[model samples]
Target: MDEALWAVGRGTGVAALVLFTASVVLGIITRSGRPLPGLPRFSVTLVHRNVSLAASLFLVVHVVTLMFDPYALLNLLDVFVPFFGSYRPVWQGLGTVAFDLLIVIVVTSLLRNRLGPRVFKAIHWLTYAMWPIALAHAIGNGTNGVEGWFLVLSGVCVLAVLASFGWRLSSRFVEFRSVRLGEIS
Candidate 1:
């Protein structure tokens, strides 16, 4: 039973990471203002929102399962309180900070309308920070380390982020060209 729970927790964590990667990619593409041919804007937006929600859900499961795992020796406070983990204090603290950032991002998104567009957008940028913090936690404390399928998954996540960022930059170049052309015209 314990093994089963641990496996499930690990799977959930992996799934959450993958969902976050996808969210970052889609967000960059959309923010570039370059419409994807044949893809409705609403559809892309919906996918981005749903992916964020799914990532959050998986994150919650990962945290809860770790707290319950007797071997992990994590308590509820460890989840909420930064750097309180009895084991691997520094690395574990990264997870706590990441959790806090995730909460901020998710809450702001949920109340985006009430928060207004500018405020909501500002908070939303925290997602980029959250990604690196999460990545650091995974790298510093992940039991799997640089082995098996885990390395491949991490590579994919990194590639997705970089690729999206590159696309956004390229789109900006295109926009600049168009603007220059208009000015000349």
Candidate 2:
């Protein structure tokens, strides 16, 4: 039963990471200058928003389950206070830091209109930082990290994020090339 609960927590963490990566990919693909393949621009935006919300929900589950896990020995303070855990304090603190970043990302996104575009965009940039921190937490603290299935899942999530970032970079390059050509022509 303990193992099962741990698996659930691990699975939820992985799922949330994947969803967050997907949201980032979709947002990159649907940028004003980029060409979104089949889906309408508005639809892509909507999907991105929904996926981000799902990721946040999964993160909540992950945190709650960790608190319950006997092995983690986490209290509410461990969730909010960085490095309070007696075991693996530094790595544990990384998870707490990631959680704080996630909260900022979600809150700013939810209140995007009220915050205004500049503020929202600044807050949203923290998502990039959150991803690496979360990834580090999983690798450092996850019990399932050594298992085959978990490894594959983590690889997939990482690859998806990398591919998305690559695509965005390529798109920017293309845009720049086109602009240069136009100027030359």
Candidate 3:
């Protein structure tokens, strides 16, 4: 039972990270209002939403399994309150913080119609912070953090996010400049 729980916990953690990475990339594309080579803009947005939801599901399972695993030494409070765990409190706390932020992001998203665009976008920005915190938690607390395979995987995730983030910023800047030039004209 312990071994099963540990495997599930680790697997889900990795799955959640991958899914979150995809969600962030798709979100950037959605924000740019651009479609992939063969897909429509609406499809991109839909995939982003689905990917985010899937990541959330995996994250929940990861936490649950860890809580049950004796190796983790996590309790209910540790899951919700940051820095409350006996095992690597800071790293575990980061995971809790990320989870809390995710909950807020999800809730606001579900109420997007009621919350209005400004509010929704503001809350959505939390994803930028949450991703890194979750990554840190995975590395600092995960037993496989120093393993070559995990390190390589983490490197790839970091690179993907950095490239996508750069694109997002550049696209926004271009849009701003175009609008300014149009106004001047």
Candidate 4:
């Protein structure tokens, strides 16, 4: 049972990583105001949201499974308080930090309408910090982080993010302002 829980935790962690990577790439695409092949421009944002939700689900499962797995030795406090775990405290703490930041991002996004665009956008920028922290957690804490297969997976994810980020910086990216001050009347 412990092994099963550990497997689920590890598997979900990997899944969350991949989904988060996709979310980041799609987010870059959405910001560029360009439609994916056969996708309307607006649909890109929908896809990004769905991917992020999926990643969140997987992350939740990963954390929950770890909490239940005796091998992991994680308690509720460890889940919330960064570096509070006895098992590889620093590495586990990174995951906790990433998870907490994600929770903030999700909550702010949900209250975007009530919070106003300025506040929402400022909090959304935390995604930039969240991704790298999550990646570091995976590399430093994952049991298979140093394995060949996991390294390859991480490499691909990194390359995809870098390419997307480069495109985001490039002038070739078309900017489409979803909101216009003049139109606000």
lDDT of the candidates, in the order given = 0.80, 0.80, 0.89, 0.92
The stretch of ten residues in a row with the least summed lDDT in candidate 4 is 176-185
Residue-level lDDT tens digits of model 1 in 1-185: 78877877778888888899999887775564445678775567777888988998999999899888777778978998889898787788998898899999988888998999889989999988988788778777767646668888898899889887787677343433354357433
Candidate 2 vs 3: which has more TM-score: 3
Per-model clash counts, in order, read 0, 0, 0, 0
- What is candidate 2's TM-score against the reference? 0.84
- Candidate 2 vs candidate 4: the TM-score winner is 4
TM-scores, each model vs. reference: 0.87, 0.84, 0.92, 0.94
In terms of lDDT, the poorest run of 10 residues in model 3 is 171-180
Model 2: per-residue Cα lDDT over 53-170, one tens digit each: 8988998998898788898778989999898887788888898999999888888888999999889988888877888888888877877766798778778888987887787677
Which 10 successive residues of model 1 have the least lDDT summed?
Answer: 171-180
Local error of candidate 4 at residue 112 (angstroms): 0.9
Q: Top TM-score: which candidate number?
A: 4
Q: Report the number of the highest-lDDT candidate.
A: 4
Full ranking by TM-score: 4, 3, 1, 2
